[model samples]
Target: MKSPKASSVTIALILLLITGWLLWSSAAAAEETPYIRGAALIDTHGCLACHSGNLMGAMKVPPLRGCELPEEEFQAWVLYGCPQAQPGRAQQSRFGMPAYEGHLDPEDVQDILAWSQIAGHEVPDQAALSDLARGEQVALKAGCFDCHGPLGQGGIKNTGSFTGAIPGFSGEQFKHLCDDGDPAAIEEWIRHGTSERFLSGEPLAGLGRSFMSSQLTKMPAYQDILSDEEIELLVRYCLHINSLGPMSAERYEAHRAALASSKMEVTGQEDSLAGPSLPREVAELFSSKCIRCHGPKKQKSDYRMDTAAAAFQSGDIADFLEVSVIQPGAPRESLLYQFVSATEEDSLNEVFPMPPSEDERLSPEELKVIRDWIASGAPWSDKQTLQSAYSD
Candidate 1:
């Protein structure tokens, strides 16, 4: 009954509506996990990146245990720097948080205040602190920032190197330094000053090796200076900062602009890994033992390891870096392997183990299977295998 032009217009409108809804739903569903609470943000965002201390109010990190600031003032001081806080800047010191304004939302501020009322008064359990927080202390004590720069923002010039600078933990400079794929390379740097992976690999290393060897500021081996535990902490810290993307407001807006005009569909398993077909045994193991938390629907930290990709992912990192759940060929470099292997320790260093429930914890034998599977290459099983696993 409608004219052709009228029908065409209606169809266009319907398509527009559909696109908008998909975009909205995708945005909403994308962040399946809860936001970090205000208190954790301190550790997660490395509020201590600039200042070192507690909420009880020190010079910069501050010590605000029992004391309370008005909401508006608190928000102003945090979201916007307090001009009054900057007195005299020492040569090696900084005042106020990083240049991140508008990254946090209103709910985040409210959450922070609420937490201070309850938990802020008590001395924080060092063991309870996030690895990122703990790693900050370790780096400070060991004087890593001297070379790496504050918060591992390495910008110190190194003559003869390809990039001509010591690489920071995150960003293009770091990717330029190494493959940026495996954290083991990070560990190797800490243990031996230079990793084999970095020296042997291409694009930079092969061409840059002569320059790297001739550089004025060479990384010193910490084998004697640091204990094994301290070494692990340092690696975690480096990886933590390396991954904490510090997405600025401007860049995110540009991302939004691109998204607004793009034809990208936000399917449910947006973060799903794409790789080799998953084997039946692995699929069965994941469906039975892991999928409840790291499944297709509800993922903690956006890590849905049980998706058809179902390769591996133990947990999230500094809240910004995007790490694939598993690296197919390397078990030692895989967080999934490390978490499963170290679950027995439940130590301060280890992340909360996969399948956090004590009763549901994987057996040693099961862990061995995971290790072997990872070492062999973490392949995702087929849909039939997944269906069969679920059936059992």
Candidate 2:
């Protein structure tokens, strides 16, 4: 009944309203909230007391913050609690978070997730710049690569041959098999149980025990250090690896080209004073040279020169030795340095100079780097820094 001009104007008004509403809804959804609310809620419920303020579950409790639990599994855990809560049992769940169903509503669970996400405590962001590198480190620390091949490419499958059995899966083939597989499924298998589908009926005798026995069985349970979300991110990393396969060659080419172009930029940066300062270089040198012999390998003569990990393992790097060496924060107190730097009389007397006679002494530059690095808090830099810088 309205004139054409009037109808067009009405339609325009309706479209404008729709657009405005959509924008507003999107902005609201994207809004950032303070992590304090979530942190407080966790604290309010005594969850922090058991789970720790950071939500890194206690000794008896599995880590919850970084877990990759699927929504349904998470729901099941909260609602029913674990079917078996006793220790030393095969149990319905590997961890003990005590089902929250009767005590906390579904809304409460959602709020918990929301709180966790805000605190940068939830499963780490898949889009995070460090996700892949961090995931790789987790995989290594967890020994995922021992069975799954480097970079989760999976292990070689053998069908048998005139030359016995050969590694059946190349890195590419392994990537293909694991692509897009549910992280939750892997977690379920790891935590709950695994199937026989791994290597099928292949009789790989020389390969030693099957993947099932070698890995799923032997690997130490990490319900302590890792969380559900972290596992999810790892699975996501598996997918990312698979995705890289189809275009891997092209990507490699592009990478090479970029490296070629950036050579000057890279060289310039390395020359810049901002390059890994003295302390880092020194720490790295120590890790490479001294740690191998004096540290964990033998701790020869009770002198373990291993990384800070050694010190962390013993709490007092001094206790393992006949005398105290490091004062932490202050390298001046670190006897390890003085021993290495010992000029005849300063040597730990009867204690053989580290690395002994056969082993090489630290290069002058190496020693300086080690000294500086030790004094600088012994920071272990991200893995890719040195490699990427030189590659560029």
Whole-model lDDT, model 1: 0.54
In the range 1-392, model 2's lDDT, one tens digit per residue, is: 89999999999999999998787455322111222233345666667566554544335654456435655565566555653222233233345555555566665665555444322222223343344445655666776655444443332232322212111112333332223254544454344334233333235433333434543224345555678767765665555444333212222222223222222322455544432222445545555555554543455545554444344232233454535464323344456665566555445453345545545666677666555544433343232122111111
Question: What TM-score goes with each of the models?
Answer: 0.36, 0.23
CA lDDT scores, all candidates in order: 0.54, 0.44
Instruction: Kindly give the stretch of ten consecutive residues in candidate 1 with the minimal lDDT sum.
Output: 27-36
User: Which candidate number would show the highest TM-score if scored against the true structure?
Assistant: 1
Model 1: how far residue 192 lies from native, Å: 1.6
Error of 1 at 90 (Å): 29
Off by over 4 Å in 1: 1-130, 176-178, 203-206, 247-392
